[model samples]
Each structure stands twice: as C-alpha cells, then as structure tokens.
Target chain A: MKDSSVAQRTVFFISDRTGITAETLGLSLISQFEGIPFIHVTLPFVDSAEKARETTQRINQAYQQDGAQPLVFATIVDPEIRSLLEKCDGFYIDFFKTFIPGLENELKMASANVMGRIHGVGDSNVYNTRIEAVNYALNYDDGARTNGYDTADVILVGVSRCGKTPTSLYLAMQFGIRAANYPITEEDLHSTQLPKALRPYQHKLFGLTIDPKRLHAIRSSRRPNSQYAQLAQCENEVKTVEAMFHQENIPYLSSTNLSIEELATKLMVISGIERRLR
Target chain B: MKDSSVAQRTVFFISDRTGITAETLGLSLISQFEGIPFIHVTLPFVDSAEKARETTQRINQAYQQDGAQPLVFATIVDPEIRSLLEKCDGFYIDFFKTFIPGLENELKMASANVMGRIHGVGDSNVYNTRIEAVNYALNYDDGARTNGYDTADVILVGVSRCGKTPTSLYLAMQFGIRAANYPITEEDLHSTQLPKALRPYQHKLFGLTIDPKRLHAIRSSRRPNSQYAQLAQCENEVKTVEAMFHQENIPYLSSTNLSIEELATKLMVISGIERRLR
Candidate 1:
C-alpha cells in the first residue's frame, strides 16, 4: 500500500479562461484534506489544442516526478480542447462537462459552449456596474466625502484601523454594492449621540468594532508609539463606539476575528441590502 | 410537453458561509443555458438545522408556485445540515459531496468537514497578506506615489480610464499581488521613451491600452465634452501609448473587451507572476 500520509501529490487547476472558477472550487475541495500537502499548478487560457497539449505534458511530467497520478481539475468549455486534455495521464475532473449536460437538459436548450464567458467581460453592463461601484467605494472611503452618503448602499462606521476600508472595497468589488466608510473620530467617540453627518443616513449605517489588542497592533505598524496606537486608547474607542451602536440602535458586528468576506456577508444580511449586480 | 422557452424557474445558491462559491459556480453553470429565465436566490450562513429547514421551505414554495422543481446548488460542509438540505423539494446538487469522496480516496484521509473553513479567516497569514496588498494597491494607485514601485509585484502603466485601477485592486484582492498603476499623462503620451519615474522599473511594467472609441465614451461619462474626452484626443493618446509599448518592449494588453479578471490573469501569465495566496 502507498504511504498515503507522507506522499506528496501535484494538483493542476486548468481552465479555458482565467481558471478562477476552477481554482476557487478546487482550492475549497483540496483544503478539506488537511494533512496532505499539494503542489498546485495553474494553466489558464488553455483554450486551444496547442495549449492543451502543453498543459498535458506538464501534468505528465509532474506525475513522473512524483511517481503518482496527478489530480487535474479542469473547467474548459470547449469540447475539442477538453477532449485533448482527457488523453493526459492525470486523474481528470471536468467541472463543466459534469454539470453542463444536466443544465442543458433542464432548460431544454444547448449549452453556449462559450469560452471565457464566466470571467470575461461577456456583459458590458454588469462589468461597468462593478467598476462604478469600485470608484464609489474609493471616493467615499474613510469619510473622505460625507456628501456622497445618500448614494451609498451601506455606510460602514467604525474607528480607525478597525477594518472598515477593506470591508467597504470588498462589498463594492465583490457584490457591486456602493459602500462608504466613515471613521468614528475620537471627538465623536467621546459623545453618546450619533455624528451629525451620519444621523441622516442612520438606516444605512453598520458598525464595526475590533478588539483592543488587535487594533493596537494594526495601528502600531502604521504609526508606532503614538497615543492613537496605545492600548488604552484603542480600548476606549472600541468601547465607546460599540456603546453608540447599541444606543443608536445601529446594527453592528466585530471584525476582530472575521475575514472581510465574512464581515461583508454579515453586513449584507444585517442591513437587508440586496446586491445590485451579480 | 412543457413549454421550455418561456417558463420561469427559481434557483437557490445555499451555503454555510457567504454562499459566494455556490453563487459563482451556479451562475457560471446556468449562464450556459442562455434563454432560460432564472430567479436567483442566495441563502448564506445556513449553518443550523433551523435555517436549513427554512430554506427548504422556501425552495418547496418556489416549486409549488412554478409547478417545477427549483435548482439548488449548495456547498455546505456539515454533513447533518447537508443531509437535511438533500430532503428539500428541488434539484439538489451538492458541490462538496460529489468531489469529497474522490479526494478522500486519493489522500487516504478523512475530510475535515469544517463549516466556513473555505471562505472564513482560517489562515491569518493569508488574510493579512491580501489586506496589506489591497492597501498597497490603493496607496500607489493612479500614480499617487512613485516611491513604492520597488515593492510592487507588477506596475501597470496606461492612459486614463483604460481600466488600470480595477485590475490593480482585483489582483491584490483575489491573488494577493501588490499592483500599482500609473496613468500615462498628456506629456508622457507625446514622447516615445518610457517615463523617467518608470525607467528604473521597466522589467516590472505592463501596459494597458483601450480602443479609442471606448476610451472616449468612458472619459465622456466622467468628464463630459472636455478636450480629454474628445474622440480625436483619445485616439491620439491611445496611438502614442501603443507605439511606446512597442518601442519599450514592455508587455501589454488591450483592456477594451476583457474583464478585470481576464486582464489580471493574462498579466500573471505573461509576467509569470505566481499568486502569493490561494
């Protein structure tokens, strides 16, 4: 029997387009087998037969070197190129082939078989929507301009270094949501009422608070030994902002342990904000 | 026979986490059947039996109303919750179930079965790398600063509105690549040589050019009727920039028809920049 625990395997994520979908799903799948280490090779733009043959050779070489069959996860929409890849020595899994037929049958229509349609700019309207949202996020970031709050789908309120900027950009880039973030300044933190700028758009406000230690560490890296980066200052700001969220009845969450994805998702759920584009 | 051309169907993307993976893969799969109208519903954070039951009810209600089963694409990790979803009145496609067994057999190990592990902040190092990269992209965006060019993974040089900002941010957000962009100015377009600021980092530079008509339209939206938005001026700038790219031998691509995902992927392939994070 092969030594399953110690043997290292090579995995390939090949696709006709950017390979993003293949890599994303493949990464999530491989992450499950925690102990095994995987050497990943991504072959994107494998749309033609020539590129397919080249990738096949690479996969074979990996198999020969490792003395094991490499696992290949492919998401090619082109049948000709995909069939060429099937001749390779690796254990091939075609994401498109497995599901496209079911979908075609269900819809009583033929699959488009269009390459790069998923990640490419297939729909100009959708593409422009995302670009505009990204611009909106940057323009309104960190309360850079409070006048644009009326157009924001969601306004993130929190102290500096509490993870508002990244969350705002993530919402915009990923979901085409117009997100504006305002830093809860020390002056505002000392009071109980909501800031004058944020009071009008109170319905769009979502509060983010971070742990004092984490906030201090994040701030110290940017500006070391400053009073703003002190642990006591961080603690006071977090405490006051969280209390303001409670008193003002603003929906809030902690970003101390959550990734931007989790934080954005939580904000979307809490605010009942529907995504503008998919 | 059922009328396939006009009937509307509902599709649900259910997951224990953000439902992003499910939605992404499902949208790509369904986009193949072009004519079918699908009402998309995303149910994220369905980690509990109660939530699963509620989603099941929603799915069944859709089925009852449409007189057709809704299509459910799920990526839940917990077996108990997934099994409960399997009983829903819809066409159940379990993303994890279909692939986990094959992976387990290959690795000779048990799957972790961890909910939210894929999209969650499971690895703090990976999370921080992306956040830092995003900050780097913003700080160096649009030639905002010239000092950080040495630290960038790739520096994008292009004319204004040729799609550099989004591509830079997408690189940082998706692949943890530190990308900085510089907008080619009126003066830089008049000359053949690379800009003095970009001279030291010629090896790290990639050019982006867009179709002149598209460029004019894009600029016109931001600044109407200005000389910068004129068709002739856009044509002149694009021609000059393309000529400069040829002379400098800096790798370049047209962003006119490509999405940000496609642009970033092509840049990675041409520049041989491996992703820093998965």
Candidate 2:
C-alpha cells in the first residue's frame, strides 16, 4: 500500500450507538485526502463485546482481502470493547480515546464513559423537543396553520417554490425551533406591503429568494410546462420577492446555492432566534 | 490559566460558511469534558478579511475580559484570512490546517484551499436531492397521498402518534429517500390485519411502536382527556401493532426512547433503503 499497490482502502466507522459521530468526524478527515478512495462501512449499535468481536472479524477480513491495513474509526466507550477493536488488523482511530484523555487532562476530571448518548435518545428531554419541533414544522408548513404565528420563533416568507418549506422544517428538526413559513404570492409582491397575517410578526420575519433558472427547473419538475414554471414567471417572482424584502427592511437570503441546513442556521443568526438545543 | 482560575471558557465557532462543521466537532470534543461550562458563540460567513478582523477583535475582547485564551474553533479555508485570525490572542483550532497537510503529503497533491464548500451548496445535485426528498415526505405524510406507495423506498405503518410522520420526514430529509407513512386505525388494529392499501407494498413495510405511557403523554398533548390519550388505548394499540408486525414478518423498532435520526437510519438499514448522499 505504501508503494501505491492499492488505490482504494476500506474504512470502518464503528460506534456503540448510531456511528454518526464516528462517520461525521471520519468523513470530514477523509475528505481532506484527495487521491485515496475510501469505501466507508458504518456499523452501528455495536454495544456488546460479542458485537465488537464480530466487527473486528469483519475488519480483519477487510485487511486480509485488501492486502492493506484498513482504517477504523470508533467511538466505543467501553475499554474492553475498544481494546478488542484495537487488536484488529487495522489502523484504529478511536475518537473517544483520542479526545477524551486530552479533555480529562485539561479539566482534571474523568469522562462519563457511557454509550448511545451523543446523537442518541439518551436524553428524553432533547428527544421530545426534536419531535415537538418536527410536529410544529409540519403543522405550520406552507402557511397552512397560521394561527400560531405569535408562538413562532421565526417566520420565513418567500415566493412559491423558493425553499421556504424545507428550510423551515430543517430549522425545526435540527435546532428545535418552531418555524412558520408563508408563501409570498404575486398579490403580496404587487401590494408592496407585508401580508395582513404576517404584519404582527414582522420582527420574526425573514425572507428567502432563489435564482430564476434554478427555480424554473424546480417548478417545472413539479408543474411541467405550466405558466407558473415559465422562466419569465420565475424571474418576475424572484425579483418581486427580493424587492419586497428590501422595501420592508426584512433580512433575506438567497437560496440559489444554499442547502436547507445552511438556510436554516443562517436565518437563525440573522433573526436572532435561539436554538433550543446545544 | 493553567492553575484553572476560570470557571467558564469562551468558545467561538467560526467559519467562512455556515460554521456547522466547526460547531459540530467542537461541541463533540467539548462534551467529553464534563464540568467546564462554555459560552458558545457562532460567527458564520466570515469570508473577508474585514469580517475576520471584526471576529478577531471580538476574540481579543473575550481574551481580555476572561483573562484566558479563548477557544476558537475555525473552519476557514482562506489562507490570508486564516493568517489574520492566527494573529489574535486565542487558542485556535484550525480544522483545515490541522488535517490538510497530512492529506497532501499522503496523496502527493495540494488541496484546493477553497472556502465553504463541504457543507454548502457546492453540489447542486445533493442540495436538490434533499429538497426533493423533503417535498416527497411532506406530500406523502400520514398516508395523505397513498396512491404513490409503489414508488416509496419504504412505507412506515403504525398507529397514531407512534412516530410515523417524524421518522418518515427524517429519513427523507437526511437520506434523500422517498418514504410514505400510513396510520393504522382502530378498525385495522382490531381486525388484526394490515391496512388494505399497504398489503401490496408489504415487502417495503417497516413498523414503529412506542411505550404506552409515553404514547399517552404524547397523545394527551394533542388531544387532551380524549379516549385516544387513555393509557388503555395506548397499550391496546401497541399490542395490536406489535402482533401485526410479528405476524406479517415486517421488521420493526421501538420509538419510545429513540431519536428521529436513530429511527430513520436504523429502519433504513432494516429495509435496505439506500442513502442518496455519501
């Protein structure tokens, strides 16, 4: 492998819970390396020593078959299980062991050494908050249930198919914020004033706009060849919505090249909405 | 500072884009240290030197006030701006710098050194897939558009408030999978048979059940004092759903103490649904 005999390597993300932490940090690190192709295998819920041994067997098999030591990234909290994984025919990168010692040394404290906590439902309160936020987002989606705008943490206003719904849902699910989204119709854009229903919650209002070409592509997929999906219509709608945002002095972001996660967190910072979870 | 004079440390999550990566890795490492309270601050979209300078001043101010080197976790990829930030009076954890050089030496290729592309909209296809999946989940939520069941990657069947809606949405939003959910009514539960509409899609079926007490609490919030919120009703529904799942050989999981992320990914593994993104 050092002589470049193999271009691809097997990478295992092992965790006692969901393996999300292992996969996340492993992927971020792997993305830094450009030429080496990695085949990622995420093995979750490996909580028992038996499960760890089985996973170790798989890792050894990968090493044998590939004729190179595999890269294993693990967050197993149990020392015995970590030792078992360490004995495998792989270059082990223990996320917990690597960072926990440094932190313990820094703070002069011991870690909890528990499993299934990070990104897991070990905390009932956090789980309930996420579920409640999801429900809230679903109920208030697309300006469907506008009665609870007073309770909303933020209100996203945009033209049809301008990424309001997904951004609202993402903010709710990830941040535990109740986000209500209202569609900015042509009438509202023409009126040059905030919607009658949203006027009371202007402080919580944020706006989204998108590139006309991309919006046209998205709208065309939904309603093919309709006047609504025409390029001119998309262009007109985007310009009008952005102009309305400017006139109203409402902070806005363009969704042309943005993901829902990006839009959600950015708008939270812009509108000063507090995220419920750390 | 080494004598541990400070009770709390100021931590800044700075990035050229959304700052999600910095926050995520920083928080994960921070959690391992049990007792030290951290004042978490996020500064996003610091793409210019001016913004970097402003952030540096803020960091210096925190250093002066706290009388300790502030912990600055940065994901900035711009060399010039990063050098400017390195001049600040803080302990900087440069994510890009710490890992990219090793990668370049390993792969014998220089990094792109670009900003804000990892979690941003650098890949339009990925962004569109997420949006498309979210829209599908919303449209197919709660069996509202059950006719498209044939197109679903997985169909979740459960009683009311057993976490079908949130799990379906989470799977779609995170994995870009088309998920359709159906609610099992009392009639179907009593009859001890799968819903007629879901019979043909049995191979794609997955089930979710929850603890009666938790279900009761959840239902009570939505429909207080109703028969639906009664503990007996919740218990009966759970028993019926589990029996049906067992009889039909449909793989199932408990949502009682699981987060939506866990439920979504685990069920995807059970149902063999492929994730759209790497």
Candidate 3:
C-alpha cells in the first residue's frame, strides 16, 4: 500500500572523490526523518567548478519540479567549488563549511584541503596492518593453518555455513584481530568432542550456531536436495553444537539474526578483544 | 615545535547500540577542522532513561572540567531519554532532533525508534551474500581455486605482498563481489607470460603493483636479511609485473599510497563493477 501522505524530497550527496562520507552522513541525517521518502542522488567526482555548476543546476531543477526545497549534503574540499555549490537553491548543509572554520581557528592554520582522505586512505602503516590482518585471517581460515593457532587471537568453531569465515574476516578487517575459523564437521558433532587441534587453543575458542531454519535455507541454496541441506540435519547439527558448547564449558553465540558487524562486536565484548581502529 | 595555540576538546559519541553510525558521522564532521585535537569518548548501551541521565551528568561534568563546551554527537532514539540528555551544557548536535520531527510531519507515521539496526546488521539475504562472497574470495585466493575463475566477477593478479588478497577480500566484504586473486611469482614474471590458468580469464584479470621502496620495506619486515627482502629483488619484481601488465594489455592500478577502500573503489570504476550497497 502506497502512503500518499508521505512527502518525497530530493537529496544530493556531492563530493570531490567517492561520495561515501557525504552519503553516509547524509543518509544517516535523513534516516532520522522517518515519515518522509527521500530520493537520493550521489554526484561523485565533483572536483571541478563545472561539475559543481551542473550539480547546482540539478538541485535547483529538483526543487522547482518537486515544489519543495531539496536538501544538499556536500563535502567539497575546494573552496571555489564549494562556493559554487553553495549558490544552489535548496537547504544547503555544507559539512565542510560547518566545521572547517572552527578547526582552522583552533589550529590557527589552513587545512591541506585534501579530498577523500577521511576513511579513504591515510598512513600506510595502519593500512598495512589491516591488510595483514586480512591476509592472516585468510591464511588461517577453516583450520587451514593449525600450526598458526598460537598466533591467533580468536578461533571460531561452528558448523558449515554458520558464518565463521565472514565473522572472522570482519574481525580482521575492522579490528586488526588475527582470527581463524574451524568448521565443526559431522564427525566432530557425532563424536561430541572438540577437535584435537582445537583443544590446545580452547582459551581462544568462540562458537557460532545458527537457527536450523536459517541454516537450512543457506545450505539448501548451495547444495539443494542433499542431506547436508536437509532441515533435519541442520536441527541435529545445531542441537549437537549447542550441547557440545555446554558440555565443554565453551562460550558461544547464535549467528542467527545478527549482522557480521554486530556479531564481531559481541564477540569482542565477550572475549575482551580490543578493536584495532581508534 | 608543538603548536601551543591548539585547542583540545572532549567529543562524545552516544548511541543505544554500537556507536558506529554516531562515531562515523562525528569523526567525519571533526575531520574537517585541522588544528583542533579531539579527545573521543564513545558511550554505547545507553538504552535506559537512568543511563541517559548519567550520560547527561557526565557531559556536563566534562564541559565544566574542560572549560570548553564539549561536542556531544548523539543518536539516542528514545524521545524522553534524548530530551533528558539535551539538558546538558555542551555543544549538542542531536542527530535525531535535527531531522526527526520534519520526517514525522512528512511521513505522517511514527518511527519504530529501534536501537542498533543502523549499520549494525540487517537483511539476512544481503548479509549472506557478503558472507558467501568472503568465502568465495578466501577459496579463490592466490590462485587456490583458479577453476572457480568462471564464477568470479573480477580476478586480481599481482606479485607476492602487493595486496591482492586484502583488496579482493575488501571487495567481497563491502561490495558482495565474487573476487579471486592470484599471485604472480618470479617464474611468471621472468617468463613474461600469463599463467595458463589465467589465460582463460584474461578479461577479468586486473594487475596490482606496489612501489619497490615500499615493497622492500614490507618484505624486509617479514623476512629480514633474505634475498626476497633485498631491495634489488623488490625492484625487479615490480618492474617485471608492470611490463607484463602493459604487454598483456591488462587493466592495473598501483597498490601504493592507496588504502584497500580506495583500491576497491578505483578497481570498481575501472572494471565497472556495481556496488551491492545502496
């Protein structure tokens, strides 16, 4: 059912480089307004005054056509280009203008006016640490490198498709944590014992289990009409894994209904692993 | 010489769940100012009104102590709790207040006022795609699954430690791309030929080469006093990789002075890979 009461306003995210920052902040700001529908337009690579002028024209046209003022969220680094954008006929929120003068006053110096450096890329060493963590996560994935267990900060154990790999990788990418994952296969579940390789790293163990229905859905998509994807098999595996976690006194978390980012954060809180990024 | 004129202010990122949205938006806003040094405090899990009062008290205390109005960037969803925190003495930028009422008027509907959904986790299917892509990237890393190249949307080729794996993983995690990366060895570089395994996937191949100096520094850290870490070897490998890329007419980008995010964006532009996220 269409909500005829909702007002649809045009919103622009203009940036000199990829408009990720502008869009992230702009969308977040707009998300607060729940009842209104926003039509988003991202004008990336808007470094030149010509592009700014064109964007200004588009903003004005949207305002004219919509019979409402459009909202402009811009982070243009160039002063001349930002000034050009400021002339647009809309409710302008120049993120750059709002904060730069205050910062300049505090520092008593001019900013380099670099484009796309915020969350873009800065400090090769920090960048390398993140990349190295990713590489470590990749190499240590799925019990591929049992010998590297001592170096791992955390080792996730769960059934196939329980999201060990993604959670491990996210921990690595976002937190610079060296995470390794080991899949709990059918044999391990039947045996009701932690794998010998994992026993040594028990202190580092964190378990993930998904709801049987969600597990079945995920597995059936990959291997349909097979026993591995059977709902019965999923239910059995999850029950067994949860039992094993209880029997072995290992802490665990349900992978169901949790985003990888959220799962990572929860794991960090539980395991006391600090985030790599400040 | 230290800048004595610089001002330092306490900045708060308050949210009911993980403070990612508030922190990301707050940091980007703070990044615009050059000379001010920010002391960041992230107070998450403030879901209760009592906690909100405590937070307000803390904010007021910080303002009094610092003798400068602290910057309070918040995303508290509860109206009463937000109203409570708004009583604090500080430079408050209530993200919820700036847009919610206008949104309420436009949509003519009430927001769920849910906590932790923004940037925390949502949509099981989309989340699964990212997990599936990460698994795919891990499986195909370093020519491990060249047979799976047919399924890959992009294949990255580069000398060892030139950042093929991390770039591929980032693409998968952030964009839900089925990315595979293959390492170009000295043999492949010296022979000046793309490996037979890669020839069939020529259209998908993208090369990465790092600056020899930076590569030397990275390699030396990993394997000190080794032939691989020698500056001469680093120079030779980069030269060979660049030549092979030019001769083979493969699209390429430098892995130097670029963050994984930037590299991913440039690769998307060059290969025309659409981002899965809106």
Candidate 4:
C-alpha cells in the first residue's frame, strides 16, 4: 500500500553467449533509464528448452511471491524457444526480434551479398590462444639487429606501418591469437623474398596490404607529416608490398576500409583456422 | 545419426546482478570439462517473470530450430523467479539453492554469528567504489616533502605493513575505487590520534587489523626476517592500531584468516557500501 508510483522493477538478461555480451550491451541500455531503480538478473548460456522452462517457472513464482511483476530482456537466437518464453506471466523484451528485422532489411538491400554458414573457429580458448601467440611474436625485439620473426603465431609480412601492432594486439586481447609482424625491408623487397626463418612457418603466414593513403594517415598519427609518413612514399611502398605478396602467393586482406573486428573475423574465416579448433 | 553419445550442451548463467559473477564462476566450472564443446550464453539482469517467459520461449525455439539442448547455471536470489526458470526446457543448476543449505546449516551451528541486515546496500558498485577509493588513497605518493594523505578515498590510518597496500590495490583494480593509505608513523602512535584529514571522511573509512603473526608473515614476503618484519614488533603495532581504531569508534574487520575476496566482501558488507548501489 506504499505509493504505487515508487514501485521498483526487476530486470533480467538472458543470452546464449555467456551473457557477457548481453550484459555489456544491457549495461549501456540500462544507463539510459537513470532514475528508475530496477533489479537485474542474468541467465547465461542456457542451451535447452527444459532449462528455459524451469527458469520461466521460477520467474513466475518470484512474481507471485513478491506481488510485483518483473521485466526480462532476452537475446535468444532460436525461434521455437521464443514461443516457450511467451507463456510466462511477466513483461519481456526480446533483442533478437528487434535486431532481426533490421538485419533482414540490410540483407535485402544488398542483393548479391553472400549467404553462407558462419563457421565458428573454435571455442573462445583456442581463438584466445592463437591471438596471444601472434601478439607475443610481434612484440619480440632482437636488439635492433635481426627481426624477431621466429616467435610469431602468424608472421604477417608487409611494408612499414601497415596496420600491424593494433591489429595484432586486438587479435591477442580479444581472441587470443599470437600475431607477429615483420616489415619487408628494402633489401628483402629487392630480393622479393620473405626472411629465412619465416620459411619454416610459411603455412602459418598471412599478409596485410593497405592503400598508401590509409597507411600515410595511420602513420601520421604517431609522427605527423614527416618524410617517413609521406603519402607518396607510402603509396609506393604499398605497391611494392602488394606485388611481393602477390608474387609469393601470400594471401592478404585489404586494410583500406575494414574495421579491426571485420578484418580479424574475415581473416579468421578464410585462414582455415576456424575449422581447426575442434 | 552418429552414435548417440551425449550431445554437446549449452550452459546458461542467469543472475540478478550484471551476471559477471555468475559468468566468472560458471567459466571456472565449465573449464573443468576439458574435452566438451559447449556453447555459453548469458541472460543478465532478469527483473521479472513476464520477461522470464519471453526468454524461455526463445530457449524453446533454439531447441526446436538448432536441436541443441541447453543446461542452465544461474544465481537467482528470488525464489519465485527461480521456480520460473526451473520450468524451462533444460537441465538447471542454481547457485543459491546449492549454497543456501550450507549457509542455513552454518547459521544453525552458530547463533551468535548472526548479523542483522546491516543496512540496505544497493548493489556491488558502491562496495567496489569504496574499496577502490581506499586503495587509491593508500597508493598516492606525493613528493618526499609532504604526504598525499588528503587524496585518499578512505585514509586507512594503521601501523606499518598492516595489510594496507595489497588490500588497497585489490579494491581499486577490482572495483575502480580510488583508494589511498597512510602509515601510522611513531609520531602518530605517540599522539594516538587518527590523521586530521581523515576526520571528514570517517564514515567512508575502513580499518584492517590482523594478528601480529599473520602481519609478520605478510611483511616477510617483502623483506625477509628483518626487524621491521619481526613478530613481536608486528604484534605490538597491531595492538596499538586496534586500540586507536576502537578509541575512535571506527569499525574494522580482522584479516587474520580471511582470503582477499572474503575480506573485501566482508568489508563491503560491513561498511554499508553494498546498500548504496541498490
């Protein structure tokens, strides 16, 4: 019989991906409702209808016991499961329903877009381990005399300042891939060959090539407008790097307009690393 | 179909908090299953039964569509809501159900151990913030001339090597609180008074008093068996520090037998910071 207006609401986030992504995203969304006091619960990685049903019953009992209704925010990817949740006695917000329509519309607009099963590379652990290995390789310094090319999980050969460090670190931190990068110096480029130690790990090698303009912009951030950061020189260097990758048949991804996530995802998808995790 | 061995399971973590706690704990549990390839999803912050139903339906749909059954691992505090989740289409594991029995048994064993619901601590954020604040205060190092005593979130005025730095850093890193510590030098001991700057923030302050033997062991890790790390001296220092805290009416927790997490959790609960987040 207290003021009805002051009643506190409870909220839950249900997802299939350890609920970390849902929780992270939900935290931002909840921040929008600053003043309302709400209780939050997270149910993560629920992968079955039986578990879902049990969770729903529990929610129903909580409502009956507390004499208050609660709200649920869910990101369930399966459709039949969504119907099971619909029978519950409380209010619910489904994220997939909200997002799917938009995704479908985008797919329609791009008629030629590829539709294929997204092969997951392995569990988070395998992906994380590989990323870590790559990072360890890239950060190896050998007293400025020799390239620390031996330690790379995947030694990426490219021209100077071609989106190596950040990409490597992102892969390592997010996915745990050990990435190493070695710049194809002028001598190596003149010979048109990868460094000697890289030969043994050629099967694990990848390359990144970017437009000189993009490279110049990226380089300019660290050292503004220097000769080393010149656009024309960058373009020339990129052309040489591309030719080398093409000649050596070292697969490369363009860094021109790709986000780090997109680049990593694409590389992971194409590199046959996705299926090797199991 | 291939031999009907156990199909891979999907695990769910449901929580009233951000699900971070459940996820962290669940991850540790799942890590025990070395060869199993299971999917993990999180449904965070489910506040009500209606929402739980919607989420349950989604789980059913996933079962129907993907043919992947799920297992739920949850930490739902509200009983009625727990029943709702139990009805879902999966095997379920609830942490509260698992822990409550033990807790009840403990209560029955020790009636004197009962502590009343101190105050309504809102959530974990306030607890974390206070811990961080205390840590930041302790770690603030000013130039050799003057002490950085004014900047502490909670100036822990305790004798030398009295479990200050480790506790402070743990609070700050885990909770993002700005913690600072000030040593109770011999001059302060002679005067037998808390620092002047700590007066205004007394409510926010916390004290950690440990047994002298425990304090000596902790100190010996840094400088082995030195006079500064002596058990007798440590015992005397602890005695003096406890007397000062008691004289000033400042509440404190013992660090003698508590793990860092347990210590921090107790401090958060006792200091009334947990209620602020809710």
Stretches of candidate 1 off by over 4 Å are A1-5, B1-5
Q: Which runs in model 2 stand beyond 4 Å of their true positions?
A: A1-6, A35-37, A60-71, A88-91, B1-6, B56-71, B83-92
Please state the Cα-based DockQ of model 2 relative to the true two-chain complex: 0.50
Worst 10 residues of 1 chain B by lDDT: B1-10
Top candidate when judged by lDDT against the true structure = 1
For residues A144-180, write the lDDT of model 4, one tens digit per residue: 2235555445656677666554455445544456566
Relative to the true structure, how large is the alpha-carbon lDDT of every model? Answer: 0.90, 0.82, 0.81, 0.56
The fraction of reference A/B contacts recovered in model 3 reads 0.38
Q: What is the lDDT of residue B276 in candidate 1?
A: 92
| Candidate 2 CAPRI assessment class | medium
By TM-score, the best candidate is: 1
Clashing pairs in 3: A35-B107, A107-B35
- Residue ranges of candidate 4 with Cα displaced over 4 Å: A1-19, A23-138, A141-151, A274-278, B1-5, B8-278
TM-score of every model? Answer: 0.97, 0.91, 0.86, 0.38
lDDT of 3 by residue, A1-278 (tens): 23465456899988887676677667766765555667888777788988889999999999887766788887788889989999999778776676667656644567768777666767666786787788788788887888988888889999998989889899998778989999998988867788888998888999999999999998999999999999999999999988888888788889887777778877876778776665
Name the candidate, 2 or 4, with the larger lDDT value.
2
- Decreasing DockQ order of the candidates: 1, 2, 3, 4
lDDT accuracy of residue A118 in candidate 1: 74
DockQ of 4: 0.02
- Is 2 or 3 the stronger prediction by DockQ? 2
Give the per-residue lDDT digits (tens) of candidate 4, residues B1-278. 12445355567777644454455445534443444456776665565888677667766665564455665667666667778888888656665465444433422321221111111123434533543343243336211112554544444446665555545544553344455655676556665467665666676667878788867876786689788898887887788878888888887877665534345445654564432222
Give the share of true interchain contacts found in each model.
0.79, 0.45, 0.38, 0.00
